[model samples]
Target: MNTVEWSETLLLDFPPMDEVHHTFVDLLALAQAAPDETLPQAWSAVIDHTVRHFGNEDDWMRRTRFAAADNHIMQHKVVLNVMREGLGLARAGNMAAVREMAGELAVWFAKHTQTLDAALALHMRSVQSDAPARRTNRANEHPVSAP
Candidate 1:
C-alpha cells in the first residue's frame, strides 16, 4: 500500500484547499521514501510546503470568519512545532527519531483533515455561495479569481 494516500474522504471539497491538502500528502510519501542520509532534506521540503499551506488556510479561515478559526490555527502551530523538533533531531543524525516523527505526522495529518478541515470546508460552503477559485498549475501564474 502507498505510505501516504489521498482519498476523496480527505478532500475538503474546496478546490484550492484540496489541492494543497493533496500536495501535503504527496510530500509525506516523498519524505518516507527518501534515503536515510537524505531524509532531512526531504523533511525540510515538507516543512516548507506545510508552513505555506497552513498559512494560506489559516488566513482564509480568519478572513472568512470561520467559527473554528482559532482552534484550527492553534492546531497548525502545534504541527509546525512538532515538525521543527523532528527536523532538529534529524539534522543531528537521529534517523530513527525522524522516522518515528514522520509516522506520527502521517497519522496526525489524516485525522486532522478528516475532522478540522472537513468542518472548515462545510462551514465555508455554508457561508459563501460561490466556491473558491481553483489553483493554477503554474507557480508564477496569477489566480484568475479570488476566494
Candidate 2:
C-alpha cells in the first residue's frame, strides 16, 4: 500500500495549519506502516489528529467567512465520517477494509491539501492581513461609543 509521506509539496505556508497537517502526516505514516497487531491503535491516532485538524480548519473557515465554507465543511464531515467507519471496521476484524481506507485516505489527502486547503490558506492570509488594517482604521473612523 502506498503511504503519503510528508514533504515540502504539502506545506500550506500557514504555520498553524502546517503544524497540524505535519502531525497528521506523521500519525498517518505510523498507521500506514503498522503491523496488523497495532494497526488499530495507529489508525486511532490518525483519526484523533484528523478530528482536531479538520475542526481547526472548519473553525477558521467559518470565522473568516471563507466563500466556500459550506462545501469545505461538508467535505470534512464526509471524510471524517468515513474514517470513523474504518475504525469500526478495524474493530470488527475487517483489517483489510481499514488498510484499503488508509491507502485511499493518502490519495484523498494530497488532493484535498493542494486544492481545498490551499484555497483556505489563501483566504486566511487575506483575512489576517486585513485585520490590522481594519484595526488601524478604527481610530480614524467615527467612534461608535468613545470610551
Candidate 3:
C-alpha cells in the first residue's frame, strides 16, 4: 500500500490544521497496513477521519471566504463520495477496491494538501491575524466612561 508519509513539507504552520492532517496521515497508514480480515474496519476509520477533516476545512473556507473555496469544497465532496463507495465495496467483500483506493487517495492527498489546503491555511493565518486587531480596534472605539 502506498502510504502518505508525513513530513515537514506537508506541515502547514497552522497548528489546528496541522494536527488534523497528522491524524489523517496516521489513519491512512493504518488503513494501508490493515490485513484483509480487518481492512473494512480500517478503511472505515479513514473514511470517518476524512469526512470530519474535509467538513472542518470546508467550514473554515466558508467562514473565511477563502478565494478557492468552491473548488476545494467540490473536491472534498467528490473524494468523500468515492471513499464511501469504496467502503461499501469493502464491506461487500471487495477489499481489493479499498486497497487500490488507499493508494490513489495517498496521491490525491499530497496534491490536495499542496494546493487547496495550503491556500486555506494561508487564509486562516491571515484571518486570525486580523481578528485580534479588529477586536482591539472595537474595544478602543467603545471605551468605558469614567465611573
Candidate 4:
C-alpha cells in the first residue's frame, strides 16, 4: 500500500493543531502498511491518537467558547463512530473494508480541516494570538535540522 501523506498547505496555521493533524496522517499511513495480523494493533494506535487529538480540539473550542463548538464536537463523534466500526471490520481481516475506511478518513480530514478547523483556527487567532506567537517563536528557536 502506498503511504498516505498530508502537505503543509493543508495546515490550519496553528502549530499544535497542525502537528496533531500531521501525526494523524502518519498514523493512518502506519495503519495502511501494517500486515493483516498486526492490523488491529495499528488501528488501535490510530484510534487512540484520533481520540486524543479530537479531545484536545474540543477542549480548545470549549475554553474559547467558539460559536460552532457543538457542531464540530458532533462531527468528531460521528467520525469516531465510523472509525470504530471500520476497526471492527479490519479486525475481522476485511481488507476491502479497511481500504474503504482509509479513503473515507482521508476525505473527512480534508473536509474537516477546510471547514471546521479553518473556522476554529480563525477564531483562535482572533482570541488567542499570543499562544500562536509563543509557539512560533519556540519552533523558530529550536528548529529541527534534518539529520
What lDDT does model 2 reach? 0.87
Where model 2 places Cα greater than 4 Å from the true spot, the runs are 140-147
For every model in order, what is the number of clashing pairs? Answer: 0, 0, 0, 0
Reference-based TM-score, model 2: 0.92
Record all residue pairs in model 3 with backbone atoms less than 3 Å apart, i.e. clashing: none
Off by over 4 Å in 4: 1-3, 130-147
lDDT of 3 by residue, 23-106 (tens): 999999888988989999998999999989999998888877788999999999999999999999989999888999999999
Judged by TM-score, which candidate is best?
Answer: 2
lDDT of 2 by residue, 1-147 (tens): 768899999898888888988898899888988888888888999998899899989988876678999999999999999999999998887889899999999999999999999999888877777776676788777533210
RMSD of 2: 4.0
Error of 3 at 28 (Å): 0.6
TM-score of each: 0.84, 0.92, 0.91, 0.81
lDDT to native, each model: 0.84, 0.87, 0.87, 0.82
Of 1 and 3, the candidate ahead on TM-score is 3
Better of 1 and 4 by TM-score: 1
lDDT-best of 2 and 4: 2
